[model samples]
Target: MPWWSWILIWVALVALSLLLYVFLGIRLFRQFMATLKDLGAAGKKMGHISPLEQAQTRPEAGRPLPGSAVFASPTVMRHDYEASKSSRREQRRLKRVQRKTDRGQPQALGDLDFT
Candidate 1:
């Protein structure tokens, strides 16, 4: 109701708003720095697995090396694709032959060609 009270109320409101913004800004800055630190660490770990080094060595379970698709030649990719396809076909043929033998059924002529 008094004139001075109106000025005091506005001053308190402005000070509280400024404090909230400063706290929020500080929190945001800390989070951003943490994110950058994590990103750098991950980059260093992944850098240890260079494309060339992985390509020269084989991984377990016929697993392709990481980033091979992005860095490998087209011919290399095609060879890998064909090899995987042929291996699958060979496995299927073997399973079919075994199943037929177990059942006392005749085998197909294609199954006999073990090429």
Candidate 2:
């Protein structure tokens, strides 16, 4: 090959590489801008919601509200957990007693709430 042909080949290769980089950079810039817009929208949506509301909403949907937990004391969280657990247990016990009574079965003395 002639030396000038080699120079032409080198110039073509450089030009193609530059074009490729420009294309990739534009794509990357567009993606970054899109991400930033989404993040801003999300921040705006979440900014108005109080931590307590986040806690209530997350638990109902079966998702953990880690954000609320961060603001609350561990003791408070444990107390809430225990309180809900005990109330559920009491409710189940009451239902069982009611079912037994309806079926004419003798209920356990422990389950009988005289109070």
Model 1 pairs in collision: none
> What TM-score would every model get versus the actual structure?
0.55, 0.56
Off by over 4 Å in 1: 51-87, 96-115
Candidate with best TM-score = 2
lDDT of 1: 0.92
**Highest-scoring model, lDDT:** 1
Query: Pairing residues by index, what is the TM-score of model 1?
Result: 0.55
Q: Tens digit of lDDT per residue, candidate 1, span 1-115?
A: 9999999999999999999999999999999999999999999989889878867776887787677698989998999999999999999999999999999999999999755
Cα lDDT of model 2 by residue, 1-115, tens digit: 8889999999999999999999999999999999999999999998998877665663556434667777989998898789889999999999999999899999999999999
